[model samples]
Target: CLGDRAAVALSRAGHFRGRTLFSGMLYAPLVMPEVITGLSLLLLFVAISAERGFWTVVVAHTTLTMCFVAVVVQSRLHALDRSIEEAAMDLGCSPVAAFLRATVPLIWPAIAAGWMLAFALSLDDLVIASFTTGPGSTTLPIRIYSEVRLGVKPEINAICTLIIAAVTVLIVVASLAAKLSKTQADNAAPM
Candidate 1:
C-alpha cells in the first residue's frame, strides 16, 4: 500500500528522474486562495450536480485531498534509496515484489504520515467544504466555521484545544517511531 501510494504520488506529480519542481509549482497555487476556494468548488459542484449528487461532493473532496497527499508522498519516494530496490530485483524478486518488500517497508512511515497529514488537512478544510458539501455532507471544519461566524463560545476554545493536542500528539508519536525504527534498522545492519 505504501509503495503504491508513493508511486501514485510520483506518477501524479509528473516527476521524472526523481524531479518534483512541477509538483511544487502546481500545489503552490492551491495552498493560497484568491477568490475563496469554496466559491470555486461550489461553482464546480453546481455544474457537475446538474448530473448527480452525494457522490459528486465525495469525488470533489477526494480530488482536493489527493493533490496534497500526492505532493507529500512524492517527496518521500524521492528520498528513498534506489539501490535497495535494485538489490531486491537482483535477488530474483519481480519488480512489484521488490517494491513491496524492500521499498515499501522503508517508506511506510512516510506514507502513513502523509495519510494523517491529508486527513488532518481534510478535517480542517472549511471554505472548500462549505462550497462543495451537499445538504447532508457538512464536515467538522465547516460546522465549526459556521458556529464561530455566528459567535465565539467556550465550546469553540475547547474544540480548538482538542485539535491542537491531537496534532501535537500525532507529531510526537510519529517522530519517536521514526527515530526508533531507524535505530533498530541501523543496529540490525551487519557491521
Candidate 2:
C-alpha cells in the first residue's frame, strides 16, 4: 500500500520542481551498500530511541524494499494508458474513485509482483535485519546463520528444502491466479 502510493506520487512528480533530486534520493538505496543502509537505519533508530526489535526490523525492511516496489510499479504506471482512468473520471467518478475502480485493477499485477519482490527480500535479508533485530526477534536468515556456525545439520537442510518448496508454491499460485484473472477478464469483455 505504501509502496504503491509512493510510486503514484513519484510518477506524477514530473510536474513538480526538484523531481530529479527527489527521485535520486528515493532510488539511492538500490545502489547503496547493504552495510551502509543497515548502519544508517541503526543510527536513525538509536537517534530516536526506538527499540531494536521486530517492528524495527519490519520498518528497516520496508524502507529498503519500498524503492524496488516503487520502481516496478512506476514502470507499470508508465506503460498504462491514462485515458482509461480519465474516462472513468469523465463519467462522473471522483478522481479517487476512478483511481480505485479503474487504475488499481489495471496495475494489480505490478502491485502483486512488487509485493512478492518485497517478501522475498525480507525473507532472506540478513544485514539489515541483523542491525535492526533484537532479542526475541531473530529472523530466519539470522537463525540459519547462527546455526550454521556450529556445523551444518540435517534440520538445516530440511528447513532450506521447506523454504524452497514454499517459494515455488507461492510462484505457481501467483502465476495461476494471474492467468485465471486474465481469462476471466477476457470472457467478460464484449465481443
Candidate 3:
C-alpha cells in the first residue's frame, strides 16, 4: 500500500514543483550500497532507541524495496495514457476516483511485478536483515548463512532446492498470466 502510494505520488511529481529533488530522494536507495543502507537504518534504530527485531527488519526491507517498486510502477505510469484518467475526471469523477478507477487497473500488472520483486529481494536479503534483526527473529537467509558456516548440510541443500523450485513456479505462472491477459486484451480489441 505504501509503495503503491509512493509510486503514484512520484509518478505525478513532474506536475508539481521540486520534481527533481523529490525524485532524487526517492531514488537514492537504488544507487546506495546495501551495506550503507543497512548501517544507516541500524543507526537510526539505535538513535530512536527502537529494539531491533522483526518489525525493524520489516521496516528495513520496506525502505530498501520501496524505491525499486516505485521505479517499476513509475515506468508503467509513464507509459500509461493520461487521457483515460483525464476522461474519467471530466465525466464527473474526482481526481482520486479517476486514478483509482482508470489508472490503477491499467497499472495492475506493474504493481504485481513490483510486489514480486520486493518479495524476492526480501526473501534473499542477508545484509540488511542482519543489521536490523535481533534475537528470535532470524530470517531464512540469515539462518542459511549460519548453517553454511558449520558446513554444507543436506537440509540446507534441500531448502535451497525448494526455494529454487518455488521461484521457478512463480515465474512460470506469472509469464502464463501475462500471456493470457495479452491474448484476452487483443481479442477484445475492435477489428
Candidate 4:
C-alpha cells in the first residue's frame, strides 16, 4: 500500500524511482555492519529528534522498514496472475475495479505475508533500531545489547530464547498459512 504510493510519488516527481531507491535503502543495512547501519541511523535520528522530537523516530523507522516491505510486496506483485486482471477488465470491470476486486484478493496472501515479515523484521532489527531510536525509546534488541555488554545473565539468556522462539513461531505460522492457501487454490483449479 505505502510502497505503491511512494513509488508513484517518486515517479510523478521525477526524483528517483521508488523501487530502486527503496531496494537500495533496505538492502544497505542488511548487507552492512550493524555498527554502520546503527550509527548512520543514529546520526539521522539525532538530527531529526533535535529538530522535531518523537515523531522523528517514527519517520526514521518508516524510512528503514519500508524497504523490506517493498521487497516483500514486490515479490508478491510479480507472482500475481495478469490474466485474471485482464478477464476482470473484459467483463466490464474498470481497471481500478479489477485491481481492487480480482487482483488484490489473489495477491492478498503474499501481501499479508510480506507485511507480517516486514513487521517481524522491524521488531527484530537491532542495528536500524539502535540508530533510529530516540534516547527515551529503546527496543528489545537495545535492551539485550545493554545487558550483554554489562555482563552475562540468565535473564538475558531467557530474553534471547524468547526472541528466537517468537521468530520461529512467526515463520511456522506464515509457512503453514501459505501452504494452506496454496492447497486451496490448487484444489479449486480445473483438473
Which lDDT values do the candidates have, in the order given?
Answer: 0.68, 0.91, 0.91, 0.67
* TM-score for each model: 0.72, 0.90, 0.92, 0.69
The order by descending TM-score is 3, 2, 1, 4
Q: List the residue pairs that clash in candidate 2.
A: none
> How big is the positional error of residue 120 in model 1, measured in Å on the Cα after superposition?
2.1
Q: What would the per-residue lDDT of candidate 3 be over residues 1-191, giving only the tens digit for each residue?
A: 67788888877755678777877877888999999999999999999999999999999999989988998998999899899999999999999999999999899989998998999999979999999999888999999999999999999999999999998998899889989989999999999
Candidate 2 to truth, TM = 0.90
lDDT of 4 by residue, 1-191 (tens): 67544433343345554656655665564466656766776676566556433465556556666656556656666666678889999999998898889877866665676567667766767766655666676777678888889998999989889878987998898789879989999999998
lDDT of 4 at 63: 60
Tell me which of candidates 3 and 4 scores higher on TM-score.
3
lDDT of 4: 0.67
TM-score winner between 2 and 4, please give it: 2
Candidate 3 positional error at 166, Å? 1.2
- The segments of candidate 3 whose C-alpha lies over 4 angstroms from its true place after superposition are 13-19
Model 1 / residue 15 / CA error / Å: 8.7
| Model 2 misplacement above 4 A | 178-191
Better of 2 and 4 by lDDT: 2
